[model samples]
Target: MNQYLISIYQPDGPTPEPEILEPIMRDVEAVNAELREAGAWVFAGGLFPPSTSTVLRLKDSEVLTTDGPYVEGKEHLGGFTVIRAADLDEALAWGEKVARAITLPVEVRPLQHGACQ
Candidate 1:
């Protein structure tokens, strides 16, 4: 089986208020349950915003750590799901469900290797 990553993208901005957030989270939970029942779920979860990120680099044999993502961009990964499927088509099917649940664009890609990556 090929492992694929189904990433949910949220444009940079203030997060939605709970009134908006709660329903989406519920929908996402429903999708997660369906994936679990279908055995298509490996793992999935939400993430903190980009502001909390820390980057570490090696310079002159010393570790240099910085705040923020590797690169500055308007978009950062909002959340992700990892699943094992027979092929890209199967993986994309999963992505479709996720996209619908979150009402956002989902970026799907096959991992180079299963588990090791």
Candidate 2:
């Protein structure tokens, strides 16, 4: 099996009200359940807001630290999942489900090395 990273991006906008939010949350949970059942789920999680992020860089062997993300943007990574699949096609199929659940684009990319395969 190959491992892929599915990145979830969220736009900079107001949070959805619960009446509209609950169903989406359920959809995502259903997908997670499917992944778990398929043995594709390695791990996944929602992230804290970007403002809570810390950036670090290496300069002349010194560790430089800064607040916020490496790039400021209207959208940020809201969460991600690492899944194991037989191939890119399989990974992309999973990506489609996540996109529908999150109502956002999902980036699907293969891991260069597979430690869990």
Candidate 3:
């Protein structure tokens, strides 16, 4: 099986109120559980807002560190799940479920080298 990354993107702004977010989170967890049951789950996690990111760049042969995301965008990667899938079609199938659960755009991409440690 190949490993895939299911990337979840969210708008750049304050999170929704609990009433709006709680159900979404519940659905996300449900998907996570399903992945575990299927033996496809590798790892998954949510991220803090992009504002908290620290970017590093190689400039003039020196590493330059900057606060905040590498790029400013209306949306940022808010979370991700790494899973094992038989192929692209299977990975996309899981990505669809995650997108539905979060009500956001999700990207399903295969890992280039191999599975994660």
Candidate 4:
């Protein structure tokens, strides 16, 4: 089986209030449960906001570290799931479920060689 990354994207700003966010969290939990039950879950997690990210770049043997994400954009990866599936189609099917559960955009990509595939 091949491994896929299901990346969740959200606006790069504050999240909704707890009252508005609880349902989303519940849905996320349900999705995780479903994935586990289906034997498709390898790993899953929510990430801190982009502001918490640290970017490190190496050029000509010099390392440069930055305080925020590598890219300055309105949309950021909010979280991700690594799943093992039979093929790209199966991976995309899981991604659709994730998007529906979280009510957000989900990007599904196959892992390249040396990337735990």
The best candidate in terms of TM-score? 3
- Find the number of clashing residue pairs for candidate 2: 0
**Which model, 1 or 3, shows the larger TM-score?**
3
Q: Which ten residues in a row have the lowest lDDT in candidate 3?
A: 108-117
In terms of lDDT, model 3 sits at 0.94
Q: C-alpha displacement of 74 in model 2, angstroms? A: 0.7
Q: lDDT tens digits, residues 23-75, model 2? A: 99999999999999999999999998898899999999999999998998999
| lDDT per model vs. reference | 0.89, 0.93, 0.94, 0.90
Candidate 4 lDDT, 73-102, residue by residue in tens: 999999999998899999998999899988
Per-model TM values vs. the true structure: 0.88, 0.94, 0.96, 0.92
Q: Rank by lDDT, descending?
A: 3, 2, 4, 1
Worst 10 residues of 2 by lDDT: 108-117
Cα error of candidate 4 at position 98, Å: 0.4
Superposition TM-score, candidate 4 onto the true structure: 0.92
lDDT per residue as tens, model 3, 29-114 = 99999999999999999999998999999999999999999988999999999999999999999999999999999999999864
Q: Which candidate achieves the best lDDT against the true structure?
A: 3
Question: In model 3, which runs have C-alpha deviations exceeding 4 angstroms?
Answer: none
**Candidate 3 TM-score over all chains jointly:** 0.96
Worst ten in a row by lDDT for model 1: 108-117
Residues 24-92 of candidate 1 have per-residue lDDT tens digits of 889989989998998888897778998899999999999999998888888889999998789999998
Q: Sorted on TM-score, highest at the top, how do the candidates line up?
A: 3, 2, 4, 1
